[model samples]
Target: MTTDGCVFCRIAARELDASVVLESATVLAFLDADPVTPGHVLVVPRAHLPTLADLDEDIAAEMFLVARSVAGALRQSSLRCDGVNLFYADG
Candidate 1:
């Protein structure tokens, strides 16, 4: 499932080392390498897409759903957290 030039795809495929937090059919959530907060997770689609517009609707939806689940998990975890901020840019 790893794509040649996409780092996220490689991580999704487990070809790259990432502190994975959660994974589903179309999504992979992992700890950010350089995080601003303790439980900062990077939720990504398994598809090799550089931009949001390039992602399929189903995959995009799955990514957000995974993000929500990860956020809930983070909040429940020992990490001190009150809220979650999910951000993405089209380009």
Candidate 2:
């Protein structure tokens, strides 16, 4: 399910434009419009989960796995980053 006005949901649904980096059945990873770092990306589940507590076990695991993969790719790229940081924001 998705929330009516949730931005992430819009992106996931292809209703909004995003620099999509990776996409799976349950998750979407994309470049942040307002990134904290040069290669900053956001990983989110397709469902409208408002908080961590709202995520199911399988979806949560998939989210982390996708994030890890993205992080690795960023480190290997010419972004000049020694490491990657994953940030979670829920509200």
Candidate 3:
């Protein structure tokens, strides 16, 4: 079963827990509950929506923008990473 609420929704609400790395009015970045590596993170929107088709187009764009911003920051600040890879698991 999924959690008592939507996994993404609860994370958006801050009702559930995840190792969030970055957050904004439209997006949130957190670690994978099941992670492949130490640096893995998941970015999402604040709105409660099951899929990208369920969200507004602008919201989707904003989410992508936030994810890109995080990547840029990581490239600038992280000494170990040459570049960041963002993989959206749902896809």
TM-score of each: 0.87, 0.94, 0.74
For this target, which candidate reaches the highest lDDT against the unseen true structure?
2
TM-score for candidate 3: 0.74
Question: Candidate 2 regions off by >4 Å?
Answer: none
Best first by TM-score, ranked: 2, 1, 3
Quote the positional error of residue 80 for candidate 3 in Å: 2.5
Q: Candidate 1's error at 69, in angstroms?
A: 0.2
- Model 2: pairs clashing at backbone N, Cα or C within 3 Å: none
Clashes of each: 0, 0, 0
Question: Which ten residues in a row are the worst by lDDT in model 2?
Answer: 82-91
Clashing pairs in 1: none
Error of 3 at 70 (Å): 1.2
Better of 2 and 3 by TM-score: 2
Candidate closer to the true structure by lDDT (higher is better), 1 or 2: 2
Name the runs in model 1 displaced over 4 angstroms. Answer: 1-3
- Cα lDDT computed for each candidate against the true fold: 0.84, 0.91, 0.74
lDDT per residue for candidate 1 within 1-91, as digits (tens), equals: 3367777877988888999988988788999889988998898877777787788889988988898899889889998888889888564
